[model samples]
Target: MVQVSESLFYKDVLLVFFEKEGYVYSNSSPTLLENIAKNLNNLSAPASAPKNFIVVHKKIIATSAFAVGGLVLTPIIVVGLIQAIGFGVGGIAAGSFAAWLMSLNGGATAAGSLVAILQSIGAAGLTAGATIGTGAAGATFMGTAGAKLFEEKSDSIMADLTERMDSNPKGQAQLDEFVKVYEEGNEDKNSEKGSTRVVFEIRDKLLTNNEAFKNFLETFVLAYNASKKLVNKKQQFKFFVDKTDKMDIAGKKLENLNVHLVKNYGAECVDKQAQSCTIMLNCSNL
Candidate 1:
C-alpha cells in the first residue's frame, strides 16, 4: 500500500509538471512578451521560492530549454521502447507457436524457416521505429528552437524601430507613412516593449506636401542605425535631429544631405544652437 501511494504521488507530481509545461508553451506561443511572463511566473512558483531570483532566472533559462526538449524527446523514447518490447516479445511468441504447430504437422524445418522470417521482420521494424522516432523528436526540438529565436530577432528589430520613432516625431511620422503605404501594422511590433511604428500614409503625405522632407528620411535612417549601435554597446542615450532637409528649402533630389546632433536626447536637455553635420556632402558634390 505504501509503495502504491508513493507511486501515485509521483505520478500526480508529473502530471502537474506536464500541465505547467503545456501551459508555458500554449501561453507563450507566437509571442515574446508572453514567453517572458511565463518565465517570470515559473520563477515565482512555489518550487522556485526557495532560491534567489538570479538562481531562479538561470534555472528558468535551463528549464525553458529542457522543458521543450523533453516535450520533443519523451514521446520518441516511449515509442522506441514500445516498438522494441513489442517486437522482441512477439517474435519469440511467434517462433514458439510455429515450432509447436510444426511438431503437430511433422514439418519442423518449414516452421523453423517461417520463424526465422518473422524474427527478421520484427528486428527490422524495431530498428526502423526507434531510428525514425528519435529523428522526429530531434527535428521537432530544432524547429521549436528556431521559431523562438527568429521571434526574438524580429522583436529586437521592432524595438529599434520604436525607439527611433519615439525619439523623433518627424521620423515617427515618416514611419507611420511607410506603414500605411505598406499596409503593415502601425502598432509597435514590440507590443510588450511599448514601441510604436510609423504609418506609411503619414510618410507619403510628408513626401507630397513637404517635398524637402527627404532630409528627414535620410537623417532618420542614419540616426536610427547610430542609436542601434549605441544600444548594442549597452549605452544609455537619446537621439534628436538638429538639422533637417532644408537645402534650397524646396529642392528636389536631396541636394544637401545634412543632419545635426543633440548632445543627449531628452526633454530637459536644451537643443544646441550650433549645428554639426552628420551627412552634408553627398558624392554628387564631388
Candidate 2:
C-alpha cells in the first residue's frame, strides 16, 4: 500500500484548485487561483503533427476500390446462383429446337443444323462462366482499394483536425472551462476519508467525451508540430485543449485549426534545452 501524508495531500489539492481558477500575477496583487487557471490552460495543449498527404491519398484510393468491388460482385453472385440452378430452361429450349429441326428434314442438312444447335449450347455455357469470372474480379479489386482508402482517409482526417487546432477559439475556451470543472470535481472527490471510491466516480465522468476529445487533441498536436518550424525559432510554443463533450458539439467547438500547410525543416530552430515545459490539463468529462 502507498501511504500519503495529510499535509502533503492538502497541499496538492490547493495547487490543483489554484491552477483551475486561471490565476495571474500583477504588479500590485496576484489572484493566485485566477493565475493558476490561465497558466494551466496556456500550458496544456494537445499534439499538433502535420497531416500526411500520402496516407490520405492512400485511403481514398482504397475506399474507391471497395465501392467498385461491392457494386460489381454482390449482385453478380446472387444472380449467378439463380442462373446456375435455372439453366435447365436453356437446356430444354435447345432440345426442343433440335427436335423441331429433325421433323423438318431427315437428310445431311438436318445433321448440319443439329451441330449448329450444339454450338449455341456451348456458347451459352461460356457466357455464364464469363459472368462468374467478372464478379470475382470485381470483388478482388474492391478489397484492395478499400484497404488503401482507409489508410488515406485516416491521414486526411488527422490533417484537417490539426489545421483546426491552431486557430480554434472555441476549443481554447472549452479547455478553460474543462480545467474549472476538473478542479472542482477532484477536490470534491478527494475531500473525504477513503476517497478512492469517490475519485473513481469522478474519473468515469471525466471520460465521457474522451474519445472525441482525444481525436481533437491529436489533430491539434499534429498541426502545432507542423507549424513550429515556420514561426520564430525562439518563440515558445503553447497549446490549450479540452478533453470533453465540448469537442463533440461539432460546429460550435472551433475552426481554422484543421488546415494543411508546408514548412521547411532545415530552416527551423528546435529548442533542445527546453525540457521542463509543464502541461496543466483538466480531467476529461468524456
Candidate 3:
C-alpha cells in the first residue's frame, strides 16, 4: 500500500509540472511525453548524454542560428535605413536615386562629394555629426521643394504609401493616382490653384518633372522598407527568446522533480545509467 501510494505521488508531481508548463498529456498521442521522458533520462547521465541531449533540443539549435543571423543582419538593415532617410531621404527606394545622383555628378562618389557624404551616413549613421548634417541638409532642401506641391500631410501620405508598396506591389498605380488627387487638392499659399494644379495647367502634367522630388520619394520608400523589415526580425527574435526561456524553465522544473524523487525514494529511483525513474513517472495519460 505504501509503495502504491509513493508511485501515485510521483505521478501526481510529474503531472502537475507538465500541466504548469501548459502541456497536455494524452495516451492516444504520447510523443510529447515520450520525448520529455527521454530527455529526463538523458539528464540523469552526465557523461554520455549531455552532448547528445543538447542536440535533441531543436529549439536551442534554431534559436542559436536565428540569433547569429539577426546579429549579422540587423546592423546592415539599420545602416540601410539611415542611409536611405537621414542622408538621401529614401530607404530601399534610394538605390535608384543614389545611382541617379552619381550619374548626375559624372559617377564619382569622390571624397567631400554629395555621394561620398551620403555613403558615409550609410556606413556609420547620423552620429557621423556635422558631416552627416551636410548631406541631410542637401536632402532636406530637395524634400522641402517637393513638399511645396503637397500639403504638410504629404509626409504622412508618403509613409502610408511606403507601407502599401511594401505590402502590395500591384496597387502602385492606384496609390499614384491617390497622391495626384491629394496634391491637387492642396490650397496653394502663393496662387488660387494648388501647386500641382498650377503645374498641370502650365505643363499639362501634375507630376513634378523635378529630379529632386523623384529621389526624395525613392529614399523614403527604401528607408521605410528597411525599418519595417528590421522591426519584423526583432519581433521574431523576441518570440524565439521567449520560447527558449519557457523551455529552460520547464527543463529546470523537471530537474527539480528528479532531485525530489531521489531525496525521498533513494538513488534507485533515478539510476544515472538507466531511465527507470523516467519510465515509472511517464505521466502519459495525465
Candidate 4:
C-alpha cells in the first residue's frame, strides 16, 4: 500500500475516469509501470517542452516511487501524455484520442499500428524498443501543448472536498474523520485491511447518512476499484512467476529456465489454474 498526495490523488481519479471510458490502458504490468514511471520521471524534456506537458509530467510522478494505487503511472505515462498534451492545445475526449492515434498509422489502428502496439504493450509487457519509443514520444508530445489546460477549476472529488471544507464546518468535520480513518486503514499492517476495505467502511459508517458524502463515495469508489485491479494483477503475475520457478525440466536449471518460461508463457498461464498451467508448460516443446 502507498500513500498518495492530494494532487496525485486527483490525477489518479482523472486516470480512473480515462480508463473507464476506454481512453487508455491503466491496468498495465507492474514491472512495465515502474520502469515507465522511472524513465518519464527522470526525463528532462528539451526547452521546447510545453508548459502544460511539463506540468502533467511533474504532477503524475510527484511521488518518489511513482505509485498511486499502482494504476495511475502507466496510463498517464503511455497514453495520457498524448491526451494531456492535446488537452493543453484544445480539449480531446477518448474518441478524439483514438482518432489521433489512428492518424499516426495513416488512419488505421489495425495490427502493427501505434495504437495496436500500445495495446499490445499494455496486454503483454514492455519491450526494450517500446520503452525507448514511449519515452521519446512522451517527450515529443510534451512540446506540442501549453499549460492552460489544468489552470481551470477541477470538478474532482478533492475539489469537492476542498470546497466543502471551506464552506461547511459540519461537512469538513466529517471529511476529516473520513481522512483519518482512511489513513489509519492504509497504515495498518494487517493483510486483511486495505484501501478498498477502508473505503467501504467509510461509506458505510460516515457517508451513509449524508447526501454529499454519498456523492463523494460514488466517485471515490472508482479509485478504489482501480487500486484493487492493480493489486490483483500484480499478485497474479507474482504467482505465475513463482509457479514457473518450481517446474522441473530436463537439461535446464530452474533458475535459468524460469525467466524464459515466464516471459514466453506468462500471458497464457496467468489466468489458468496452477495445475493446468503446469501441464501446459510441462508439455510445451520450449
Candidate 5:
C-alpha cells in the first residue's frame, strides 16, 4: 500500500542549465520531450539563469558522460525541460539533414549507428546504470500530465530514413558510388571519425557546385522557417559569448551549426575565411 502511494506521488524539481545556442536539447526520452514541449512557454531565461529553466518531476532521468580512452563512462540521475526556440529546433534539423550520410561503412547517420547518432548530435545522453540501448523505432509517448508530441518524437526519423535507403536500388547505387569515393579519399587515417570527416567533405564538395549550393541553402532555410513554428512567440532568447576567437564569420557559423544567419551569410560570412573573423556560439541567455 505504501509502495503504491509512493508510485503515484510526484516529486517536483527544478534545474537551471546553460543554454548553448544552436544546441538546446539535453536528453531524448519521451518524458523529457513532452516536458520540454509542454513548458516551452515557461522556459524563459531568468535574470540570473545562464541559459534556460527546467521544471521536471521525478519521472525524468538525467545523465552526464565522460569519455576515457575508447570507452564512455556514463552516470545517470532521475531528474530535468529542454525545447527552446532559435537554433534549438534548427540545430536538430541539421542533424536530421545529415541522417543519410550514406552510412559509415556499416553505420548510419553521422554518428555511425542510430544510437551513436543521438549521442553525436547531443540529442541523447547516458542513464545512470541503464543499459546501453542502441536501436530505434517510431512511436509516441505521453508525459506525466497531458503532454504529447506529434511524431515518434525523434531519433526515429533518422533511423527510418536509413532503413529505407537499404531497399532502394537507386539509393544503393548512389551509396556505392559514394562509398567508392570515400574509400579512395579515406586511404589516409580513415576510421569511424574519418566517416564524419568524409560527411563534411561531401558537403563542401556539393556546395562547390553553384546549383547544388543554391538548392541546399533553400532547403535548410525552409526547414528553419518551419522549425520557427515550434517556438512560442512570447518566449524570449539571447546569446552570450562562451569562447572567443578570430576567424571568418562563416567558420563561426559552421562551428556552431547556427541556422539564423542565412539572410546575411553570403554577404558577410562566406568566402571570408582568409580575412579576420570573430568566433562565437549561442550562449545561455542573460
Candidate 6:
C-alpha cells in the first residue's frame, strides 16, 4: 500500500513534469517483461476483489501472496494528497486504499487511462505493499526507503536543484534554459523516441548528469511520514486523508506537495530532531 500523494493520479501530468524535467529512456524490454509489467500494473489497477480472492496473479508474483489494498509508488497520479499519503503509509503504490476496500464489495473496475498514467509513474517508483494492520508490514519497507531518501537527499540531484531554487534563487537563467531544452526536445519530433530527454542534458549543464537521477527520495519520505502518521493513530487513519475525485488531480497540486516535503524531511524539514525512518511492504510474496 505504498502510495505517493503527488504521483497517484498525476502520472499523466508527471509525464509533462518528467518530460519537461526528467528524462525518458526508450529502454523498452521484451514481452518477457510483460509479467513484471503486469505485476506493476496490478499494483495500480482498481481492486477486483477481496485481498484473499485476488487469485494470486502468478505471472510476476510466484507465490500465493495476500495482496491487500495496494497503491502506486507513483506510476502516478490522482489529485488527492493526504489520502494518497495514507496509501504510501500502507506500503502500496499510490491510488486508493478505501477504493481497494470498495472493490472487495463492488468488484474491481477497469480504469484504462488511470492505470496507464499510474504505470508511467510506477516506472519511476518502487512498488511495494503490506497487509492491513498496525504492524511492520508497511512500516518495514517504507521506513527503510524513507531513511535512505533522507540520508541521501543532500547529495541527490533534485536536492541540489531544490537548494538552488531555495537558496541561490539567482540561477533562474540556467533553470530556464533547462526548460527550453525540454521544450525544444518535445517539439523536435526526432529526439530519442521523440520523447523527453532533457533530464540528462540539464543535469550535465548543472554539474553532473549521471548523478541527477530522479529524486524519488520524496516518494519514500512521503511513505515514511504517512506511515508514521498512520501507525501512531491507527483508528484515525481515515481522517488523515481527504478523498478527492481522480479527475481532480492536477500538476498544480505539487506546490503544496513541495511544501509538505519540506515540512516532512527535505532540507526544509522543520522537526530537526526527528529520527530517520525505515519502512517496507508488509505482504510476503513467495
Best by TM-score: 5
- Expressed as tens digits, the lDDT of each residue in 144-199 for candidate 2 is 64344323333333333233333444433344333321212224342343322111
TM-score of every candidate relative to the true structure: 0.20, 0.19, 0.17, 0.23, 0.23, 0.18
Every candidate's CA RMSD: 24.3, 27.2, 30.4, 20.9, 21.1, 21.8
* Per-residue lDDT of candidate 4, residues 181-209 (tens digit): 22122332533334222221222222223
Order of all candidates by lDDT, from best down to worst? 4, 3, 1, 2, 6, 5
Give the distance in Å from residue 12's predicted Cα in candidate 3 to where it truly belongs: 95
The whole-model lDDT of each prediction reads: 0.31, 0.30, 0.32, 0.34, 0.25, 0.28
Q: What is the lDDT of residue 42 in candidate 6?
A: 37
Residue pair clashes in candidate 3: 89-219, 89-220, 90-219, 90-220, 91-219, 91-222, 91-223, 92-222, 92-223, 93-222
Instruction: Report the Cα lDDT for residue 15, model 5.
Output: 11
Better of 2 and 4 by lDDT: 4
- In model 5, the clashing pairs are 76-128, 247-277
Better of 3 and 4 by TM-score: 4
> In model 3, which runs have C-alpha deviations exceeding 4 angstroms?
1-82, 85-95, 129-286
Best by lDDT: 4
Candidate 6: 10-residue stretch with minimal lDDT: 233-242
lDDT of 1: 0.31
Candidate 6 stretches with Cα past 4 Å from truth are 1-22, 30-37, 44-47, 51-256, 259-286
66-115 per-residue lDDT for model 3 (tens digits): 33323222333334433543344342233344454443333445575545
- Regions of candidate 1 where Cα sits further than 4 Å from its true position: 1-133, 173-286
Worst lDDT 10-window in candidate 1: 277-286
After superposing candidate 2 on the true structure, give the runs of residues whose Cα lies further than 4 Å from its correct spot: 1-137, 173-286
lDDT of 4: 0.34
Point out where model 4 deviates above 4 Å: 1-139, 142-160, 174-180, 185-217, 225-286
Displacement of residue 192 (Cα, Å) in model 2 is: 34
